[model samples]
Target: MQSIAVSMNLLEFAEPVLIWLALFFFVKSGRVKRFPMMTTYLAVRAASSVILELILNLQRFASVSDTLQNSIYFYTYWAFYISAAISIFFVIREVFLHVSEPVPGIQRFGMLAFNWVAVISGIIAISAALPLKGLGAGMVSIGFQVMRCVSILELCLLAFLALFIHSLGRSFRSLAFGIALGFGLQAGMELITSLIAARSSYLDSSMNIVLQVAITIVLGGWIVYFLSPEPHAEREAITLPVSSPLIRWNEIANALGHSTPHVVVGQSSATFLQDVEKVVDKILTKNSISVNS
Candidate 1:
């Protein structure tokens, strides 16, 4: 028990440090502008971890009352939780946009689809949380449901990238793929831990530790990916096959919400009218000659 507590404390301390390191590398790699939401997410996570740690320490050593401490912690934790949850959607979107950057049409269409998915997921989460008792409990439930939805979306995004990697002409080693991979791993761990916790209350403590370890691994991986130099080949343009489904879908998506080209009779209107009148007069004269014959 002492060992487990010590390990958990160490993990808690290491997490924020690792997060800060990863954030530093992310900016150093010059990806901050490209993935602003992801940068924001990392900042939020790091700040929340530090604040929550301070709250925990205050509860142990400070003169604060239990009620006051609980209130502070509750509001602080929930506020950050909500912020992180919201930022994650945008983070996922950043990854998607980066992956589809080669195809503007697909990027636009995917963003629209992603927006609809987000709306539907929120509706479902709210519906699921409606049955819970009390406002506080319901809000917590909604957060969990919303995160679960995001997890599923992350997994789907990872799968889409994997399955269409060739079609999209993207390398697996690209930064975009790295971000998706990390999120997918984190999401998968959350889902598995959630299932395990649901199945047995006794494993909840173990699962928490496991989840933290998984997160630590993912953050470390992200740090390495951001710090390492990318391959020169990755920068070269890729040519997609004509028969690729990605190309076909991109074409179809491009065709959507666009009007057919129309000829505009602007300054040439008078000349066009004169030519049309001459052709009509000639046709009328030919018809009149035929009728007389």
Candidate 2:
């Protein structure tokens, strides 16, 4: 029994610290903006793991029965599960923002709606599990049901997010790969858990932690790959064609007062026509328009 307790303690405590320490150093070597999203995920995970470890330590010290300790462990695990889900959602959103392309306004709004739904569902699950300060209607049944529902919503959101990533095309290579792999693992785990009974959901719990760590590590790699400044490309790029005639048109328009007439001052009709043609050509070139005429 003591050995069993020790094993649980080590799993809950040492594992998270080691994983997070790896995460901490990996992130410290990269850009600051990337740190907030990934670090937030790791931080919540660490807090939840430590809390679970303390709960287990208390149970061991007080010599609680295995059944009671298991019950406590189950509820605590759900709280952490919901938190991790929310964190993943945030990481996905951050990736979208980092891509710097405009998503459809409706799609953007859809992501927001999904975020709110996840938050509300997670709150409900947490409420059901812990009630007020760990004094709830003690059982894993309700929490499990709520989590199943959350997982379904997450599944749908994952699909929408996948489409969003797909629309980004090739520039999102690292981000798209990470997102698809993470969502695939997460969705697979959730489906398995939802299909199986709670007590026998070993793969669900174990795979979730594994997927999260993998996703976090991959996300960190993606950040380093993408977010690092593109100094070489910036230096090598051609300057925009600001000197093109289309931009000069704007200056010409400003120079010509609102009441300006269309007469050419000291030119023959053929020369005037030629000047207009040149102006039009300049306008088209400057504006990046292909004028067939």
Candidate 3:
């Protein structure tokens, strides 16, 4: 236990350092401008680690069953946890955009699919939390579980993109690898930590140590990926003529309740619909001219 304490202290101290460095590079590399959600994620990590460290110190010294300490713990934990969760959700979407940037159609479709994934995952998380409501650490458990699933999804998304487009360019792969490293480990560690703690009601310092180490590795990886020379992607020109069938299929997909323009918070249905309309009109007009000729 003495060794455990020393290690945990070391990791806890290191977390903020790594986070600050990660934040620095995130902005320095102009990633903050390109991927605002990821920038927010790094900022949250730095802030949350600092806040959580303070909270832990207070809780350890305070007498058990102290109401004020408990209240502070709950409120602060939930605040950071929720913020991190939301930021990660958007980060995943943004990373997908980066990977699929060359393919506009795929980008649009991926965005649509990601909306459904977010909605379903959120509903599942809320339902899971329902039973654990009122438990002191229930919200944290819920947040971790939801994040674990999302992180796994992120890994799969990256894997699929890599597999399908073996040459998505160097810059794209670099970003994708950085994201996968962070979230892939996150998903695995959170699955173990969240499940074990929720079942036993015991929060182990060892888990905290592991979490910090994983995060440090991820932050360091980000720094390295950013510093390396960005490989230029050879993008193929895509100019497939859209047909009436393609438009009908899109309309059918929308009608089948597969669309979430309204359900996806912050997504503008008006702009999305307008974009779709323009594309469809252009396609139909081109087809009409070709047929007439």
TM-score of each: 0.80, 0.48, 0.67
Model 1, residue pairs in steric clash? none
What are the Cα lDDT values of the candidates? 0.86, 0.55, 0.70
Clashing pairs in 3: none
Better of 1 and 3 by lDDT: 1
Q: What is the lDDT ranking, best to worst?
A: 1, 3, 2
Residue 187 displacement (Å), model 1: 0.7
Candidate 1 weakest ten by summed lDDT: 230-239
Full ranking by TM-score: 1, 3, 2
Pairs of residues at least 3 apart in sequence or in different chains that clash in candidate 2 = none
Assess candidate 2 and give its TM-score to the true structure. Answer: 0.48
RMSD of 2: 16.5
Could you tell which candidate, 2 or 3, scores higher by lDDT?
Answer: 3
Q: For residues 81-106, could you state the per-residue lDDT of candidate 3 as single tens digits?
A: 77787888888888778666545555
The positional error of residue 184 in candidate 2, measured at the CA in angstroms, is 3.8
| Model 2 lDDT per residue over 116-154, tens place | 876776676666666534344533544555556645655
Worst 10 residues of 3 by lDDT: 232-241
